[model samples]
Target: MLAGKRILLIIAAGIAAYKSLDLIRRLRERGVSVTPVLTRAAEEFVTPLSVSALAGEEAHRDLFDLTKEAEMGHIQLSRVADLVVVAPATADLMAKMAGGQADDLASTLLMATDTPVLIAPAMNVRMWEHPATQRNLATLQGDGVAVVGPNSGDMACGEHGPGRMAEPLEIVAAIEARLASGPLAGRRIVVTSGPTHEPIDPVRYIANRSSGAQGTAIARALVALGAEVVFVTGPAEVPPPEGVTLVKVQTARQMHDAVMAALPADAGVFAAAVADWRVAKEATSKMKKTAGGLPVLEFAENPDILKAVAGLEDSRPALVIGFAAETDDVIRHATEKRARKGCDWILANDVSAGTGIMGGTENAIVLISDAGAEEWPRMTKTEVASRLARRIAEALEAG
Candidate 1:
């Protein structure tokens, strides 16, 4: 899967530069081409000669090397690669990236490159814990920058909690995941994510605790498998992945309309936890606090998106998947939901508080269909999405 793929490796200022050398060697062993770039501070730790010798390519260090610029300018250098990896992504470089600063070659290449980026951060535990660092991390993640890890263990410094760079093998796995393509190529799919907002007032709305992690991961996985994904999302905590058609919506009705408009797809994965009801009559103006007693509000059923799409005789997706978040009788409820909604499958999960499935990073899902209910053990939302995407690909290939 890694053969002939080009990786632009950016070595930032950190004590973990040694790890990056091993990273380059590992990439080369997997038949991947590595182009190394070293920041000025990176040179303090690892020599350019060593980096170039390991990579078997000249290490690019300056943003404005007049000779290289004349040959292949910075813009060309940035665009020529399939992916860019930032190793030993120190706090300062991360902050700079979050702020879109292009003061150095590494930062400028990151800003200039359209290729996907994966960062491996390494720093002091205290620096990693800083709110500023956390905010920076969030910003980068939201902008679709992939991160490997700062695995927890003893750091270069005396104190340790987190902030060690991930092992070379782990990083290689992440790279392989990013570059891998599958049978889903040339297929188009639609995925809905996040909890739909039901407006009670202009400023206030009723929403569930869905953080949209699973749906977003599903979309990312689909994209990785060479699928053209239409991602329809409501207010989601995580940002949509790069290289997809993103449609943002606010309410369940809006989400439904968006999904329907992106129709004639290979599949439709309705993972959104849409609200069942909305205010019967939304006030044209914000209702003010009055001396009168409490106002009586009415409720109206929101549009049933899953049923509408699945029941369509002419334009239904070949594979329709709905999500059932049940607290009790999970399989029974999901089975009923699949039948009622006319969807091909229903992925059921327990959203009961203790499960921590809802709005959390991990998911324990049950895949229910006409065949039977297959129980899947607890796994990360990303793993679940990847497995689901692969299943969809297999089903489509068979069909």
Candidate 2:
């Protein structure tokens, strides 16, 4: 799909700038035409000559270059490409992109571009984790910028964490996904995953046994089918899939807000195992055990996110899907829940003792809809996700 496509590759200042060279070669090998751009600090690591040599084109550096500007203006340069990719997107560069700064050639092109943008962040572990950087990352993702990775590993600053840029092939795969023309192309999906935690104290909280494997697999399958997915997850044991707009939350209320904010989607998959109730009045400090005998804890019902979204009159998704984990009468309970929640479909499964399906790798699903319940054979979570994604695509297309 990348054949004869054009990419504007922006290299920012970072030790990972070196990887951008190999990335250029990989794209070229796939018959992609690359237009390389370098920030001033980027020259400190890889020279313009080397970047130009590999890209088979002149590396654009200065925004005020008279000759280059006379030939091709920055505005034109930004819109000419199929997609703009920023590799080794440093903290500073990401901040500029988020804040709409255009002092440099790279940021100018980024701000001036209307095409989709993908970024591969690489920075120090501390810098990557800093609140400001995380805010910028969230802003960029909210603005529809796709992210490949800043995979966790040892950093050049001798710190070990999530600050490493993804490998060349990984970025290529993300680019291909961004440019793919699959059945669900141009569709936007919202998927909620993991178990929401209701805080009892700063350290202690109430949660469930949800690994988020199934939801993560579902998001991956949707992305592979070329859908733009907004993945809202809690603290899951599994890492989130790439090529998604990821929103992290702690409580059911937070997840509800996040899902509401990402509204008007083509469909919504409420796969999260949300807590039904939370402590009415959480303790500010840790509860003492010896001094005050067992304290009475009051409970309050959490917001019904699935039901709320399904009942939305204005922004309700065309197709709303929910999950039911039951210990008895799976189909009947799921069907009733589907009707009560006003969702289009409900994927029900038994999580009874010894079933090992809740946190396990396999699942047996009974899909409940207006027609009837359809039982599916036991399969891997990935297979289930793929099947569900395809079904969603068909449903959307039919509608």
Candidate 3:
């Protein structure tokens, strides 16, 4: 599955560095080209010659090596690879990575690379349990770094807990799974995310707690499937995925225009909780509260973006998916919405404040479509995106 793929393996200074050698061999066996980068500390556990021998390529060491830099620039080296794998990533390396401290080749390449990075942390049980390490881990994860394992078991220090590097086979499996899960390859999918702000005044507006997590997750999942995704979002708290085409919009009208402009695509996923209504005439300035009389306000219906695209005669996407944010009778409402909007599918979610699904990491959704309404158990946004992408791919293939 890794055939013809270029994988840059960054080896950190740790006892687990020895296992990385086996990982190189396993990866090469799958026809993946390996370019190994060794940290100064990594030389303590394994030799450059051994790694080179297994990889069938010269081991990359010393960021300041004049000859190597002249031939292959560090920035170019980092950008050339499809993915970066950091095994035996020590606590020091993790801290450096999380903090953008590039004192060495590995850290420098890590900071320079635009590719997806998978870090397998290997450290002492105590070090891994340290608060600083935990904080660094959160930072890395929040920065969109993928973590494999620091599995709990007997460690090299003769201590047992969560500090072991994932086994070579396990790491290979994870990598392969990542490669295989990309089912939307070569397709262009446009997704609208977050809550639109309908201006109530200069300072006041109508908005919702849509963190944009699900939309960002959907974009990332699509990227994994090799899809070129245009993510139209509002002023979301969460960061958009790397390498995505991002369009920031504040109002429903702005989002609608962005989605329409990115048209003639394979699919469209309307995940944003766009405000249903906007002030009919927004005040040029903030409306002052009158002391004696009640202030009157008028609301106008926002454009139905999903219906607009689904009912398009010429540029309609092959698949149109809409999100139904309901507080009650979720399935019934979602089913009606799917038909009313002429969308192929509706992802229904309960967004009651108590449910915490609106701006939270976890979600419980019902997939309502012409086929049927399938209730999906609560899952992380990433997992939901993965399953949805797979289902979409299945539908496409079946047709």
Candidate 4:
């Protein structure tokens, strides 16, 4: 996805501008063509010669450089690249972008290009958190712009919070996600992950030990295979992957709604550990101690999302895979689950105390389908996800 891809990197003015120099080197190392567009204030931190020396391409600094303009017009320049990245995207620059300002060459290219744009915001924590800046960020995100990060940490300004620019490698990952192309390029997939939290009260909830590692890995694998993934997640320990449509949910009912809204997907991966039941009547306020000696909470069965989607008469996914975490009779239980739920396949894992497959990194699974069950050796969750994603691609292609 990175090789041979051309990126127009717009270096905005900030202390983080220095990081952009390293970013160019990293992208080039990945065989990406980097074209640097340095804003006027960017020159204060880094020179065009340094950027050009590293990128092996002339850094475009002036909005009206006659020689460069004659050689490659601004419109042509903007149209040539597959993607435009704004590194060290300062608060001012982001505001201008959100406001549709095109006063300079960098801004002009951003406004002129139809190519997908990604930005790595870098600013003081206060600026990043300011209501106005947040509004601008929302506007850019709404316009389909991909954002890497303004990671929370100690800032160069000696302040703390999420204002640090993401490392160059992180930006590269974001780029790869946007440029991914493979057999599932145009396919849409829905993947549910993590343990749904059923609220007992405003401050209390019931949840499982599901770390959401496998589901997040699956989403990443699907994205790597060029599928547009709709990641419907709960309170996951791991953050969701890049380059996928992220839908955050809580209770089983919310997850069901999210999954339904994400259709019509090409495939569905039910990987969440949703609770079978929820509090029949949730407490609006915190229950006071000693008020009730013992809280007798009534429970109601949660929605069966897998069964609902799998048994769909219309708008059904071509492939529907469910996960069964069992403590005993794994194979038999999973085989029965596949039939009971009407799903195409079920990946069963032994999550008993010793197996450590529930909140652990490694997984041992049995892929159960209509034909029969196939046992698989223990492997990292990521490996399992990759293998499963490949199987999905082959299955989808076959049909």
Candidate 5:
């Protein structure tokens, strides 16, 4: 899909810099021309000769090279590529980009570029979790930068956490998604996934059987169609898909706040199974079995996320979709829910005792809208997600 596209790859300083060599080969195999740029510190990890050899182009190093500057000015070079990627983006480099510092060639080119930017960050565990680095990441995202991964695993520093750069193939997928020209190309979407947990005590909580497979698949499909997705997920059984701005929350209130913060989107898919109520006064410590009778807990209603978003007069999404997991009277309840919530569409499903659809791979959906009910055949969750994504794209285009 990315054939004939040109990429300007900036390799920053880190142990993960070695992965860029394979990344260049992967891009070339897909008919993508890669122009490599190496930072001064990056030379210590991977040589310019190796990068140049794999890319089949001379690696650009110095910002002050007289001959290269005369051949191609920095401003012109930056604007010539279809996209610019920074692999193994160190914490320092990210801070520089966020702060708009152009002291070196890589930062200068980034500051001058009009093309979309994608970064795969690599740093120590502590550095990745640090407040400063997180602030810089948020700033870059606000400036329209795309991020792939800083996946959790073993780090070179002998520490283990979310500070590793994404694999070469994962980076390739993100690049393709960023460059796609499909129907949803310039749209920004918000998707909520998984079941929210409401604490009963320090260790006990209330949740559901939602696995989040459908929501995750939907987000992936939207990304493939070129929509920038803000994925707000709870503690789900499945990991989030690549190529999305992920926001993790635990409680219903937290999920509601995150969804609200991601507003002004083109559309919203509310698939999360949030708890209806929470303990009114949670115990500070774990409740123990004592001679005293079982403690009675008071419950308070949780925020109605879908209703609030749908009722918004301003900064509301053009299209709002909600999900209903029903055990009885599916059509009647879901249709009533659509009217009560004031959402554009509702995807209702039966999760009765023998259905095996709640935590299973398959889904049987009943789509409800103003035009009335449309029953779909039972299929895999992934298939349902793809179909839903196409429908969403068509809806936006019609508007």
Candidate 6:
């Protein structure tokens, strides 16, 4: 969809300004053309030459260059692009944008352009969390501007909470999403994510290493594609993406209930690594240590959420997809799971130790359907989510 798209890239001043280079490269690799605009403060962090080299076009910096304005005016510049993206959106810049203060070129263009604006905020944790920033964010959202992330992580300033800029790859993905046309604009999608916890006692529980990255990405991707998303997640380290309804859960049964309550949707992506078995009877108090022998646990099967939804006659989604995380015979297990669960499609992946795929960043998946199994190469979870989302859109169009 982005083959000939024109993107106006605006870089704001911050330590995270360096990531805009990779963001430019990723967009160009996707055959999208970029025109760079750097704030005066942005010049302190990265050179115009470096940005221009990566963008393959001249960088626009000054708002008051008489000769440059004559050649290509700000009005002309703002009218040409299909979308405008601001990376490392600083606290100062966002405040000005929200307040309609256009003292600079970038802010002036943003105000002049009818083009949709997307921002990825990067600042200190304190600045991001301040009530003033929150108010500004609310104003932006109310004005229909898209905000991506200021993810929580270790910061360059040596303090950590929220307010680190999203990675370059993530920014690229966000742009792709913004450019995507919403065939499912009015539709609703419900997705389940992460590994469910089955409690053993007060202090202990059984769980898997599913990081919920894939599921969270799917929810964000669906939102990008214009679907209202309800993200049901288990205990996951990564926070849910912005602009979506979030349902947090801890156990398989809780996830099942959430999915069921959020149903009658257009699609369902069952990406959660729900525990198949759970303790039949949970111990109310902490279990004491056994001195002579190993303690035995009674087990029971958890509710089959996918199957239940697929079997629904009235409230079932148009498409129901399930996931199979297998160690051996991945495709075979996935195929069996599809038939047994009565799902429309099954995504199978090998989760062996040392693969780093379980809770890691990248994945290799085999998509199994009634027709056949299609193997996909190893890629980041975001990439996988994008391809899957497109495939889902194609399938819906075909149907």
- Which number leads on TM-score? 5
- Return the TM-score for each candidate structure: 0.57, 0.75, 0.56, 0.64, 0.81, 0.57
Q: Single out the weakest 10-residue window by summed lDDT for candidate 6.
A: 239-248
lDDT of 4 by residue, 1-399 (tens): 578999999998988999998899999998999999999999999999999999999999887989778876788779899889999899999999999999999999899899988899999989987889987876886576777776667887899876888878777876787778798876778899999999999998888779999999999999889886778899899988876656677899989987875667789999999999999999999977885588888999999999999999876899999999999999999999999999999999999998877888999999998779999999999999999999999999999
C-alpha local distance difference test of each model: 0.86, 0.91, 0.84, 0.88, 0.91, 0.86
Candidate 4 residues lying further than 4 Å off, grouped into runs, are 1-4, 7-79, 83-172
| Candidate 3 lDDT tens digits, 145-180 | 766666667886899977888778767755654454
Name model 5 segments beyond 4 Å from true.
Answer: 14-22, 28-31, 90-100, 123-139, 152-164, 198-204, 238-264, 278-288, 295-304, 307-315, 339-342, 370-373
| lDDT tens readout by residue for model 1, 93-177 | 9999999999988899889888888888899989987989987976886576766667667877888666888778867866765
- 1 against 3, candidate with superior lDDT: 1
TM-score of 1: 0.57
lDDT of 1: 0.86
Candidate 1 Cα outliers beyond 4 Å, as residue runs: 1-181
Residue pairs with colliding backbones in model 6 are none
Q: On a 0 to 100 scale, what is the lDDT of residue 65 in model 4?
A: 83
Residues 87-195 of candidate 5: C-alpha lDDT, one tens digit per residue: 9899999999999999989999999999999899989989988889987987887687887777768988899977889889888888888888888887888999999
| Clash pairs for candidate 2 | none
In angstroms, give how far residue 259 of model 4 lies from its true place: 2.6
Q: lDDT score, residue 44, model 1? A: 96
Task: Report the candidate with higher lDDT, 5 versus 6.
Answer: 5
Q: Which scores greater on TM-score, model 2 or model 4?
A: 2
From the highest TM-score down, the ranking of the candidates is 5, 2, 4, 6, 1, 3
Residue 371 C-alpha lDDT in model 2? 86
